[model samples]
Target: MLHRSLPIRASLLLAALCLSTPAWSADPIHKETVALTAGKAAHSVKGQIKGYATAEYTLTGKAGQTLSVKLKTNQPSNYFNIRQAGQDEALFIGSTSGNTYQATLPADGEYTVQVYLMRNAARRNAVANYRLEMGLRD
Candidate 1:
């Protein structure tokens, strides 16, 4: 009787294990760094220019997983915009005096960030260089 009961217990344990979610199956965290450079041609006829110092990053995660993004700019601008891939929309657009920006992602996928300089001609001439620090948060 004891031996016969051992087989039933083993079968039950196997079933439970099969039904359990796999810990390793969860999506892995990803990150990448990108450099941006703007030249004189990027400026307008009046020498006023506003463009992005962009960075490209690939994100991989489960369908329902949440993604967080943070960005640090070299300098504050009059306005800025954040664009995502496959969506004809802007994630964020507004004025910022601070150098850092943050946002929560809607889904799991690859995203591209473009940090534009919103300074006017006078401000543009004041800036000859800039840097953007971008990252993803789990």
Candidate 2:
């Protein structure tokens, strides 16, 4: 009888724990291709984001070429991450570092620049308007 009661108590505790945990409301991620001018090495794009929504821009790059990214945003919590085509983790984190990132690409492939607001701002439904500038050169 005691064992049965213990199991019930454990189940209730588990349920409470699950309910107590805060859940994030998922928002759809926006996608776009970074199109540069036919004879240009850089391009800039303007966009808006809010909540948990994200904007991802895909661009092609080559190894040994310099990749530069600058994100200008209306909100301080807004940031971006750069990830190689097949990677799970970001190669650059804008939140920890600043909003500008420049590196010599490691491989020749597609890269994604993801823009979003921090959780603190996202949860508040704050909006951010931004301009993302990207360039690649030798």
Predicted structure with the largest TM-score when compared to the true one: 2
Ten residues in sequence with the least summed lDDT for candidate 1: 38-47
lDDT, candidate 2, at 69: 91
Q: How far is each candidate from the true structure, as Cα RMSD in Å?
A: 19.7, 5.3
lDDT of 2 by residue, 29-124 (tens): 999998543236579999999888999999888888788999998899999999998888889999998899989989988999999999999989
C-alpha local distance difference test of each model: 0.44, 0.89
TM-score of each prediction: 0.40, 0.78
Q: What lDDT does model 1 reach?
A: 0.44
Top lDDT hit: 2
Candidate 1 residue spans exceeding 4 A from truth:
1-75, 78-80, 94-99, 122-128
Clashing residue pairs in all predictions, respectively, total 0, 0
Q: How many angstroms is residue 5 displaced in model 1 relative to the true structure, after the best TM-score fit? A: 99
